[model samples]
Target: MPITGTTRVFLIAGDPVAQVRAPEIYNHLFERHGIDAVLVPVKVPPARLADFVRNAFGAENVGGMWVTIPHKAAMMALMDRCDPVAQLAGAVNAVRRADDGAIEGALFDGIGFVKGLDHFGIPLEGRRVLVIGAGGGGQAVAAALALRGVGELAIYNRSTDRAADLCARLAAASGGVTKVAASPDPAGYDLIVNCTSQGLKQDDPLPFDPKRVDAGAAVEDIIMTREPTPLLKACAELGISAHAGFEMLVQQIPEYLRFFGMPELARTLQDDTSEVRALLYPK
Candidate 1:
């Protein structure tokens, strides 16, 4: 896909943008569909994130922006409208500027995540779950699990305050679902999710010991590394059903395209994803 004077542009912003898979998949969608657009990656530090949203994101060529990591939480304040999902998740991973100049923020992490869990036969309804990280991805997944009518929800974070706050928020919106902020204990959980970037680096420590997770439980990590992450590999060693991080990201592509004004594009990716997955997670 070549750049042109009239090319419409979108961006995926994060502090460490090099590992992002969004630009690849999104650009492929744009090229194959003949859309005069490009989804580019930009390393926007925390200090400059606000300025980018206020000025750069409002440019004529800028059609949308995808938020990641540290920026996902900070983006809410910059959006003109925050969707219900984002409001509940306390974060937004996708944002699109409406024709009226309103930037509507939305969350797709949980939608994609839970969809993968369902496809893999790991049902969320009435099941107890534990989430690690309590960051943008963690919050979104936790809120999604709560809305799915999970039996219980527990959150763990390095920062106890963050974990406690997220637990409170999820509890308030979780209805009857029991929510707790506790250390990573996989004793009674049906599913344990690692929403942090720990698996991105080989030296990174496991978010929690896979052996601590009950033999009957399932595990998932939301980090796509060069290979299976240590945590997922450990889960595999323990004979647990471990899900790939790509599942969450790929499933969310449709939601993102719709938010970007290409609603019909969702159908193109509705069923077939083998090719896209290969392109994204290249072995």
Candidate 2:
């Protein structure tokens, strides 16, 4: 919708905000749905995050904000209330103000990832899954898969301690359903997800051997790139199905809208959003 003085604002805040495409995708949705809201990217450095949260989010017309990159975990400390999912994941990627004026938070990264896989006809129920990287995104995916009833989960990180910590946290939260990967080998798992930044650079090493990825297993890279990440390309060459990271971002749109109290946009968004999706794969 055209921004008026009364237009509600939603912010996607990160230090390096130029690379974020959330404003494009969400602003398109808002305009198409005729909602009087706008989503904008804000470059808020880590040190100033707490003050920004206190001042900006308290605005009467501010709907909510999406947190990204180094801010996801930090936002958790800033929220007055949190959804159970965010609590278990140890992070919050989005937040909205409550009726009582409290900032309520939710973690949607894993939810989006699972929905993206479902869109591709990949089911997690009873599947053995391996997630590489135990950072915020990795932890969120692991927690979501466990709650979705995946039969087994293996978490692997360069830091064994971080992976092990995520395992223990998930196991405790999910009643003993998660474990640290014995090895990074991915031979037999039904699903392997790369949640790390391994594929961002051309010379970046593969997180794991593509040969070890079974042809029967599906591989997903969580790095949003214009071209196929190295891991995805390797998986395709090996006859393993692969998916891009933005699949998760796209699939999470409805959830984010709902959290922002704009369920109307979720339903009214144009079915053909190819142009918007293309912008996500920036050159």
Candidate 3:
């Protein structure tokens, strides 16, 4: 429902809010749909997220929020209830404020990435997927894929313990089909998903040797800013199909809109891709 007075406000909150593209993309969508809504970025320190959300809830215009980075796990504690994916992933990346002022949280990154893969016409069912980095993002992606009935999932992290824990969790959830293991062998896998922060900075070594990557496999990097991270560039040179983080960003918005009780607006806005691309990949 639209707000009674003025505009409905949405926010994406994280430590480093200046770099976020959500406001641009979402505001454009709001404009296109003729909704009295505006999306903004909010910079909240890790310790202040709970307070911020509490205060924001009192404001009648505030509708929803997007949480990112270090806060995805922390934000779950502030919500009234979490969606199934958020509960399983142990994190929340989006939150919606209901008419009663209750907050509902959900994790969209994993599902969004799979939606991106689908957008590119890539199939995950029965395909062997190699996921590097067993961090929050990796765990979310692995769980999402397993839920989609992927044939095999091999997860690797620098810390073997983390990988083992994540693997065990996924295996239990997947009914023993998802396999978690160490090593960057890209061979025999249909998809390679990078969920680490390694590519966010320059001069970072390739997480794994590019030569070992299967030439026929598709590569997906969750880092959004740099279009061609070293790993993606390597995959490209080797004739591999690759997807960047923008695809995930684009795929996530619709789910977020629905969580905020605006499914029609979400569907209407998603029909246009040019505006989203322009916001995400501004020159």
Candidate 4:
């Protein structure tokens, strides 16, 4: 897959794009699969997101865009239509223009998070879960969890109102089947997921006390840094099973491929993502 005039270009936009790992992961997949596609990262400030998106989509060769960080929530308004999950989560991480020039949007963070849990054999059905964050990522993860038949879902955010709002939305979407509420308490939960940026900094304190997590409970931090976050370290010390965000990210590759109209490639990758996982997190 040499870069050529016919290459399908995909842009991933964020204010600080240097930290993004999508280009490396997706480019490797495209090249290895003999697909004429390229994913590029672009630094677009929040104020210029709309303009940047409009101008980028004007180019005929542009296939789609990947939204990150501050852009996910804002990207929702830019879509002609959004997937139900995106609407429920109030965010969109992937966007593409249809043959009719309609902009379609979707959020894969939550879906990927749940799938990653499955990949690690962490059961979710009928399990009590606590999500510590209510931002875009948190909302997406919580929304997905509620729909996954979790026995109970609790959200904890610095802003109680935000967490409460997300819980309400999730409860309504689940037809009252999911017992969701806003609470920072992690005790008694079967699984705890950290969806906050607290773990991004080395010195940042653990999102929640691992000692408070129940015995045999598992924890997952959605922070994708190579170094283990403090939360992971604390869980390890407590003899609790903990995981990094690598699997969650690795799991999203196929979803993005399918959203971008590469269904065949998506299916192929879904059947076996070990190669991608190894590339991202080598043992």
Candidate 5:
């Protein structure tokens, strides 16, 4: 089929857009499926976010955008209405312009993390999970895990108030059944999630002492790098089941594509996971 003006356009906006690998991942998938859609990263400073997004919707070719970093929380006010998840998470990572010209926002971080675990056949139901960090990613993880019927959730952050606030929000959304606690003990949980940016730099310390992590717990870090993060490395050294951030990234791409009204593109991209891996993790 010949492509026409119907070509779909997607944008990912963030302060440090240059470090994002979304363009490489989505572009590879688009080519593989012969879709005319293209995904690009846009460097939008904090001050320009509102204007940039408002103007973006004016372009008929623009399907949607992927929000990131410092913009996630700030972008919520710009949307017409937020999805329940985004509302609860207090952030928006994906946005779609509705037929009525209304912009709808959603936060996919939690769903993506949960899906990644599902992809590995890891069950969170009835599992004791500990999440470190109470920021955007942390809140998302808590919400996602609660939805999976986690037995208990322990959230620990530098600021106890923020942790408590997120716990209260998630508990309300989970029908108050999701037990939220505050603890830094790693031995008490079945799963550990690191949502902080600590691992992005080489000098950052592990979120928690390796000695405290339960040997039976499954560890997950939302940081992608050639070498395992200190936390992941410690988990590996202790013989614990662990995963890197790349898995979560791959798991979320399909959901993002679907949000843009291109399920066919999502499926096509999902079908070419091997090629994506090659591009993202070239030998």
Candidate 6:
């Protein structure tokens, strides 16, 4: 299909839109599935986010926006309503205008992270997990991990207050099923996740000391990049299993389709994501 007036437009907004893999993934899906849609990246700084979103949505042909980086948490305030996860995480990765003209948002990062863990054959129930960073992605991953009935969930961030607040919200929502706390020590945790943007650039320190991570524990860096991040390199040197964020984004594809009003496409993807995975982690 050619880019024409009928092509529904989706914009991904971020300060640095160059690192995003959504357009490559979603556009491939649309083209392969014969859907007349296009996803493009748009760089919108923090100050102009509200204006950009409002004017972009005003266009009738604009389908939705994929929130990224600094925009996720801030986008929540612009939404008329958000799903429960978004409310809990105070962030959203996908947003769209409803038929009633109300702006709606949803967070898929947590579910996608958990599903990605399943894909990696990592156990969640009754296991100790440490999530570094209390930003939008961190909050979403922690919230989803709590729902998985983890034995203990520890949040580590530069700001103790932010991590403490996230723990409080999870406690209320999970009814204390999962023990949540604020800690920076990575020792003894079965699973450790790096949800910060630290690994995105050179000279950025690893979120946690890989040497301190317990034996048999797995580490995951949620920064999407084609190359191995410093954290992953450190993990490999220590002989520990470490994975990138590609799988997490891959798992979110179906959820994104469903959120964008393509239930059938979502179902088809849920049934078999092998092709998508292969595309992300090709030989």
On the 0 to 100 scale, the lDDT of residue 283 in model 2 is: 50
Query: Which tens-of-lDDT digit does each residue in 1-283 have in candidate 4?
Result: 8999999999999889998888998999899998999999999999999888877889988999999978999889888899888999999999999899988899999999999999999998888888988887798998888778887788888888888788788887665644444455678889999999998999998788788888888899999888999989888888999999888787898999999989988998999988787778768
lDDT of 4 at 249: 82
What is the alpha-carbon lDDT of model 1 when measured against the actual structure? 0.82
Q: Compute the lDDT for candidate 5.
A: 0.82
* lDDT at position 80, candidate 6: 94
Per-prediction TM-score to the true structure, in the order listed: 0.88, 0.92, 0.90, 0.92, 0.91, 0.86
**Per-residue CA lDDT of candidate 5, range 1-283, in tens?**
2335787889999998878878877777677677788888999999999999989999988999999888999999889998887888888999989999999998888888998898778888778888888888888878777677787877888888888888888886665654444566678888888888888877898887667877667888977777888878777777888898787677677788888887876776576666656777888
TM-score of predicted structure 4:
0.92
**Cα lDDT of all candidates, in order?**
0.82, 0.84, 0.81, 0.87, 0.82, 0.87
For candidate 5, the per-residue lDDT at 86 reads 83
| Tens-digit lDDT string for candidate 3 (1-283) | 2444788888888998877767777777677777788888889998888899878878877888888777898998889998767876778998887667678899998888888898999998888888999888898888788678788888888888888887787786665766666587677788888888888876788877767766577888888765578878877778878878788877787888888778887776478656666766777
lDDT of 2 by residue, 98-210 (tens): 99988889999888888888889998888999999988779888878878878888999988999988888788666576888877789879999998999998678998998
List, residue by residue over 125-195, the lDDT tens digit for candidate 1. 77888898887788888878878888888888888888778777777667756455567767878898998
Q: Provide the lDDT at 2 for model 3.
A: 45
Q: How close is candidate 2 to the true structure, as a TM-score?
A: 0.92
Model 3 CA deviation exceeding 4 Å by range: 1-4, 99-101
Model 4 lDDT, residue 31, Cα = 95
TM-score of 3: 0.90
- Residue 115 shift from truth in candidate 1, angstroms: 1.8
